[model samples]
Target: MAFRRYLKPRVVPQEVEQIVDALPHHNVGSQGYDPWGLNLDTAKISFTAVRWLYEHYFRVEAHGLENVPADGRLLLIGNHSGQLPMDGVMAAYAIATNPHGPRLPRTMVERWFPTVPFLGNFINQVGGVVGDPKNCGKMLEREEAIIVFPEGIRGSGKPYRLRYQLQRFGHGFMHLAMEHRTPIVPMGIVGCEETMPSVTNIKPLARMLGVPYFPLAPLVPLPAKVHICFGEPMHFPDDARDEGEVERRVERVKDAIRDLIDQGLAKRRGKF
Candidate 1:
């Protein structure tokens, strides 16, 4: 009992507590855990660690945050880069600290992430779920916000030569968005590609390791200045059923992100 008291106040900073407490979280039970294994205390602690990277290490600059609705069933779609998922981390932080109000967004993670010991559970505690269409559909129905990267490993694992060139986007997110009637806020992430700057992907090693393509890059991510531009929320008609129509709509979202990326690139002084 005494340990719990000590752990609560001292472990979690007061400012972080205020941020977490201020946010509106849905479907959390009396035990402080949600159906997806989100524990408020765990989120508070995790924020303390990621907050340093978001603020000091990466020196992230977030724009268009007000465009993110404070409450709703929505999708935060963005380009994925960097060997790690730091882009998503910074985006999550930006939304949580938006001027409008704090919001806890569930990030859709790759299935293989859960195969890693300890990492998966930590992710889940901080509101990461496997990127399954059914999972996303259920969350949207409950009015929970979600973050998705349609490019998956194709974007994240790409080599430095292809930086800023968006890979093909899966049509699944568009289908889910139209089906659920969820609005998508396109995010353009700049500077993460420079953080690690993969020269080549060690596909053989990745296959042996049973992971996605492993990159020959820096052991730790460099402190590149990250700029995240959040575009205005985009809503599509829920009536589209043809695959071609869905692909076209997805391209529209990609275009929004691409434009924002250009803005971010133009905004930066240099890649640090």
Candidate 2:
């Protein structure tokens, strides 16, 4: 008689809802109000969190902060390189720590992030909203400071093959800027690439874990010193009403960010 073996079925993991019930609840429609709004109090809290992490844990150095506007609807465009989303957190910290009437800029993040377990809840608490065009427009309409990484996940997940090189930026941000007449500020973030140098891809594991993409970084602890530099605000020409003209302005912003990154990398070569 042949021996028979029985194996238990494997359990497929389902996405767990991670929304924080403890946080103050507000209608999605009333995202502009004080109680559930992007006001100074909330911004200060977020600033404190990021600052504490940077000072105590990362020791990040930030320069060219004057480039951030004191008040108005402005779009901060920057390169993403951190193995994790630490760059965004640090950028938020920078804005919150600005001495010249500091304000926490609302960040537009990937839509999928809100579905993650603990991360989604924490990001939302820090005033990070979904990176959809509609959400961006609404925030701009309220004259809020919005930060965006046009390269999306591709920039954040930059492989060792394309370190510091920017990916193709989507044009939706440009259209929103033109429509809202908001100034575009270009910023360059360095050292995040070194924090975690992604050398390979692990698709099967990433899928199993329910993450959009998984990266293999040889440098797990991120020994490189982190530095972020801001460039002078670049405004879109009001006279350029044509779509083509608007595109030119968008490209200009992208170029400015690229140039700043190159300059920053050059400055930090020996140290980083």
Report how far residue 49 has shifted in candidate 1, in Å: 1.1
Question: Which pairs of residues collide in candidate 2?
Answer: none
lDDT of each: 0.92, 0.70
Question: Tens digits of per-residue lDDT for model 1 on 1-272?
Answer: 34435676777789898988888976899988898888888888878878898899999999999899999899999999999998998899999999886799999999999999989988898999999999999999999989999999999999999999999999999998888888999999999999999999998999999999899999999999999999999999788768888889999999999999999999999998
The superposed Cα distance between candidate 1 and the true structure at residue 90, in angstroms, equals 0.5
What TM-score should be assigned to candidate 1?
Answer: 0.96
lDDT of 2 by residue, 49-165 (tens): 555567765677778888888777889999987667788888877776676646657788898887877666556655788898888887777677888998888898778779889
